[model samples]
Target: MLAELKELFATWIAAVAAAVEAVMDRLASRRRVVLQEIDGDSFTARLGSVAKGAGLRPVSFRLTPHGRPEPPLSPQWRAALRSSVVEVQMRPDQVLFREVDFPKQAADFLDGMVRAQIDRLTPWAAGEAVYGLSPPQPGPHDRIVLMLAATARAKIQPLVDLAAGLGAASISGVVTVPADETAGTTIRLFNTRLAQAGRLAISIPRLLRGLLIGGGVAAAASFAVSAYLGARLDTELQDVQQRLNQRRAALRLNQGTSSAELLLTQRKRSSASSVMVLEALSRALPDSTYTTELRIEGDKMQVVGLTQDAPSLIRLLEQSPQFTRATFFAPTTRAAEDPGERFHIEAHITPYFGSGS
Candidate 1:
């Protein structure tokens, strides 16, 4: 149960972070690097310039067979890689591509569906391969066409691992497939950036959409809690009012009985209300204090409660206009199971006829 609670807390934190990811993007490093994976071995790279998403002229690097680039890089390039967004585009021949059609309604579940049948569709099992799907395209008979690209993890792990080892700020694996009649100009097949700093990550537009969705969900929850509390408070107020009405009716019945009855009625009208006493206590007590039991006898009241500082409660109750002569009635004690000190306090409840109601 504790493990589940911790996991739930972590998930909530992650969701909150994701909701505010857009604000974080404003402080992110924009330096970019595009590494073109060549011959399943080496790469030709381009560094980002003043222009957004554009890179400098591509430079060929002598690289090992699907391993590290040869001749350690200069400090300048290494430093750039530390904060640069690195995108590795694999050669078309490196990835296996296929087209699959499904009911358009299944578009949202395409990732799970493709992954489930990956072994049958590709040469490798799901776990053995890195896979991705292109944006769905509308097809005949209420269907959608999806392009699937998959490759052995062994083929891509080296490049991703190398980028991370070099301390690339962010890494991505991308592949280009031969576009068909159904496919427009763009078809993004795969992206795997589990490098030192994780992937290039979710896009800004998606992040903003998530923020809006989270806001909507939070607003709905607040409304629900507010409505529930409002209903409960109204019910409590009505019950208190009903009790006051019953007391007033009983007093009126004995109004002209005798001199004793007249004095009793006057005393009853001038006495502090139990509801008012409770309200005053609730407002005066610190949030850390919780009352487990309460007793009212004549003009005095005794309350048993748990608090972080039992002695401080006396001063608080005494300061309130509704209570006075606050003192501990029983010794404060702490039990092994109790979270805080438990104390019994007695206070004089002052009567005031400030309002007839």
Candidate 2:
């Protein structure tokens, strides 16, 4: 059980690692292409420089307002733009900038936070404008300061469309920086795209595949456990049934009969017998008393007879060891033709006198 759990954990970890590596590789393959809008009429294009170990050099180009080649780009520039991730810098007047202070904890969610503040900081509502922010800078007290940049979606969409028409693989964003400061912080105005919006869609199938594998493993383990428990319970039930059968067999061998038959015989011997009760009554009653009807049910006996002295019969029956609690059930009366009174007596029969032993 422990080993199976360990294997499952290891499998999940490996799956997660593989998914992370795949996403990282996809991001690394994307090239950064920058375009700085010089004026409404012209723009400068450049390939962002690669890191030291990358063994690549930067290439630059210029394009007219109509997207016609100014001097004609080299083969490398054309190739780079075709597969590159594009970013366009808008002229300062074309974009709006605002400085806002927020809680430190909101740093991670600045894009959404800044978007919510767009209508308050600018004339445009959040949906009407395309907006982005600079990296948060430390502020007074515990707050953070950030530069928010926004432009009308109408103004930004044309540039984005142009970049796409020029064969850029994806548009990264629009940025704005102060002209005087060479190292001025750039604030992004828009970065969201249809493809980037659904980036996680690529990982959905991979995640589902992993979940299915894990679910299958769990189901198989559960089935194995259920089968094992069912077998164990069946074995236990069989063992109990076998032990009960053995006990019954031993009892039959010792008693010379099945348990039910032995119980019936013993009950008959210990219970009241009609014949034995009659003999006991005969000895208890006077000669003048004669029984006409007698009935025995369970431990109770009833007698109907003609007696010279009906009341005396109760005392006589109670004194006998075979009967108890004797009493007249019917009123005693002298009959016109009979020599004695008609009487009915009821009593409990004792087990001792009826036992054959």
Candidate 3:
């Protein structure tokens, strides 16, 4: 189960990484403008120019506070803003900046932690504030320092609305710098548009589309591998089954040209043979003795016949190798139709007569 979770996490990471890389590549090739609002009636505009080592050098131009170009350069500047990504910088007085200290452990969740404390950090309530945080820096002890910038939504909404009305593609971010501080200490108030309901609406879909295409490709590859393994397993099973069938056929062929019935008959003949027993009896008894009835049951034999001397017949039968325990079962008596005496004898038949005789 842990293995499956790790695999799922890896897939998501790959998808997100791919999406970010695509967006970054697109942005790297494009130019952008920075608009710094000085007052209600005027602002400074800087067009970004690519420098050595993929850096940007801004070319500054002043614009009217209405987001239109000023003086002789108005038309050219207006056209540039429409085609480039716009970042607006507001005056520090229009936004609020506060330094808040938090435990170093809260670094991972600084955004949520700071937002939750916004009401206490500033006079504005959470709903009335548009806020953002600077990257956390080391504090005095085991704590981290963050600069939280916030402003009433009413104060910043009008400027965003004006930029949208001027046909800007999208407002990227809003930052502010105190007149008494250096440019490095600029505080970001709002990184997303307040006038638009969903920030990154267009970019979100583009990233999602890239992720979907990558996921589809991964799914297709997995299916192809599964199908290939399944087919290979099936083929191996068939080959094994065919080999077993061939071995069975070879065994049947080697057993001679007989069906199941013929094999059974041969086995029965080898176990017991009545003809061999009869031949052994004929050799053991004299021609002078005549038999009227004879019966063989398993290894025992019974005889009812006429003999010149019935008592002597027992001795003769017992002396034979094929018979044992010869004795008279009934009394010998002379009969009118009989030439001599009528007698009954019984004996055990040896198994040697069945197979060897």
Which candidate gets the maximum TM-score versus the true structure? 1
Clashes of 3: 1
TM-score of each: 0.49, 0.46, 0.46
The positional error of residue 186 in candidate 2, measured at the CA in angstroms, is 2.2
lDDT of model 2 at position 181: 29
- Ranking of all predicted structures according to TM-score, beginning with the best and ending with the worst: 1, 3, 2
Candidate 2 per-residue C-alpha lDDT over 210-324 given as tens digits, one digit per residue, 9 for 90 to 100 = 7879999999999999999999999999999999999999986978756788899889877877778888889999999999999998999999999888999999999999999
Top-scoring candidate (lDDT)? 1
Model 1 alpha-carbon drift over 4 Å, by segment: 1-23, 50-57, 62-67, 179-186, 189-357
Task: Give me candidate 2's TM-score against the actual structure.
Answer: 0.46
Off by over 4 Å in 3: 1-34, 38-74, 119-128, 167-184, 192-243, 246-250, 258-357
Query: What is residue 150's positional error in candidate 1, in angstroms?
Result: 1.2
Q: Can you write out model 1's per-residue Cα lDDT over 141-185, one digit (the tens) per residue?
A: 999987888788887667666677777655667776665533433
What's model 1's overall lDDT? Answer: 0.76
Go through the candidates in order and give each one's C-alpha lDDT.
Answer: 0.76, 0.74, 0.69
